[model samples]
Target: MAARPIIRFPDPRLRQKAEPVVAFDAELRSLAKDLTEAMLAAPGIGITAPHIGVLRRLVVLRLESDAAAQAYLNPEIVWFSPETIRHVEGSVSMPGVNEEIERAARVRVRYQDLDGVEHEEEAEGLRAVCHQHEIDQLDGIFWIDRLSKLKRDRLIKKFEKLQRLGA
Candidate 1:
């Protein structure tokens, strides 16, 4: 498996909704493997297909320190808890800055495995946060979207300046 380059924020491709994986064939499996490798290489807990320029409904996540990495195909959150929790989230796409975002404390997700078997899993705590974040990426949403308009604008301006400086 190879590491795929992650597309950064402000790229139009990141705003495009991903397509569903119609066949659970070898190509799909290989893409998932490459995605997993890319996530691990980036030292991140979660990654979505769109982040690597693949417009497919796929995600890779490993929340627990000792848990094995898992890939999700056509993943979607089917249930969410009333309880809410807030955490500071950062992204590989954004690099240094992080923003506080509120998310559901618990969630139930339905997704397909490598073998194309459907499964529903309940997640809580950091796992829940990771799932929610990755799901948003599949929908072309970024963590900065959760910030206030003013704050989002300021951060974008900062990134733009950084880009201009060739940094």
Candidate 2:
């Protein structure tokens, strides 16, 4: 599979909610494969179909190089823990900027496998963080949306500067 082009930030499509995956077929599998290639090439642990302008509720993640990459179709977080943890998060769309994001320490997500088989599981630590992050993208919630007003303003300015400087 070829690596899909990752759309950059403020692309408007990233802000649009992704459509649910209705058909679990070879096309979906191919898209997932392309997403994995793009994610790995992006040097990011996680990515979503929206990142590549597919606008489908698909996410591919490889938290550890030693572990197999996971593809989740129509992934949604069903529960979250009261405890919260802060982790640095970024996006392939944004490239170089990342900030500490505070998210639930654990989450229970309901997702579909490649064959459209339903599965629900709880995740903790980094896995939990990654799940929340990607799910947010599916919901049209950008990671930077978690930041404070001042921090977000500063980040956009920096990102704009980078774009201007041809970063």
Candidate 3:
């Protein structure tokens, strides 16, 4: 599969909610593959269908460079630990800038596989953060929305500067 072009930051599609995926067919698999390829090419550990302007509830995560990419369909965080942790988060769509954001330290996520098989998984640390981040994106919440207004404003300005510099 080939990497699809990623929708960049400030694109209105990034703010639009993704539709739930209903089919567990070859086309779905192909889209997952394309997402994985696009993520790898972007040097990002995670990405979603919406990153490429395809508003489907799908996410692909490769937590480590050598690890196999995992695809999740219609992923939702069913539970979140009261304990929180802060981690630097960035987006494939919003390149060249990142900010530290607080998120649940652990989470239980219910999601379907590429074949539409439902599964639940517990995640902690970085995995947990990624789940919440991606799920938020699926819900039309950009990562910066998690930050303080001052922080979000600063980050957006920085991102805009980078864009002007062609970074």
Candidate 4:
């Protein structure tokens, strides 16, 4: 599988909700592989199909570089702990800046494997953060939306400046 091009911030597709993955076929597996490759190329720990312009509720996460990547299909948060934690978060689509965002410290996520087998898992700390972040992406909510308007505006300006300089 090859890494696909990632859509950048402000792309309308990023704001559009992703459709659920209905097929548990080779194509879905291939997409999972592609997402994993693209995420590694982006040097990101988590990614969603929407990041690559595929409107599918699919996510790939590899919290540790040396660890194997895990793919989640149609993932949804089933429960969240009241305890919250603030972590710095960024997006592959919006590459140059990150903001501290508050999220559930623990979560119970219900998702399906590539084979369409349903599974539920509990996560905390970074894993929990990644789950919420990517799930928000799947729902067309950019990570910056979690920030204050002032912070979001400042971060977008910074990102735009980075893009101009990089170009």
Best by lDDT: 4
Q: Which ten residues in a row have the lowest lDDT in candidate 1?
A: 90-99
Per-candidate TM-scores read 0.91, 0.96, 0.97, 0.97
* Tens digit of per-residue lDDT, candidate 3, span 1-167: 45799999899999999999998999999899889899999989989899999999999988874359999999998899999999999999889999999999999999999878899999999999999999999999999999999999999999999999989
TM-score of candidate 1 relative to the true fold:
0.91
Q: Write the per-residue lDDT of candidate 2 for residues 25-97, one digit (tens) a residue.
A: 9999889999999999988999999999999999998988437899999999999999999999988999879
Clashes of 4: 0
Model 1 Cα shift for residue 28 (angstroms): 1.1
Q: How many backbone collisions does model 1 have? A: 0
Single out the weakest 10-residue window by summed lDDT for candidate 2: 60-69
lDDT of 1 at 87: 84
Which of the two, 2 or 3, has more TM-score?
A: 3
Clashing pairs in 3: none
- Give the lDDT of residue 66 in candidate 1: 41
lDDT of 4 by residue, 64-122 (tens): 74369999999999999999999999999999799899999999999999999999999
Name the candidate, 1 or 4, with the larger lDDT value: 4
Task: Indicate the residue-level lDDT of 56 in model 4.
Answer: 99
Alpha-carbon deviation at 9 in model 4, angstroms? 0.4
Candidate 1 residue-wise lDDT, 32-150, digit = tens = 88888888887788888888889999988876674778899999999999999998887767665677889999999999988889999999888899899988988978878888999
Q: Whole-model Cα lDDT per candidate?
A: 0.85, 0.93, 0.93, 0.94
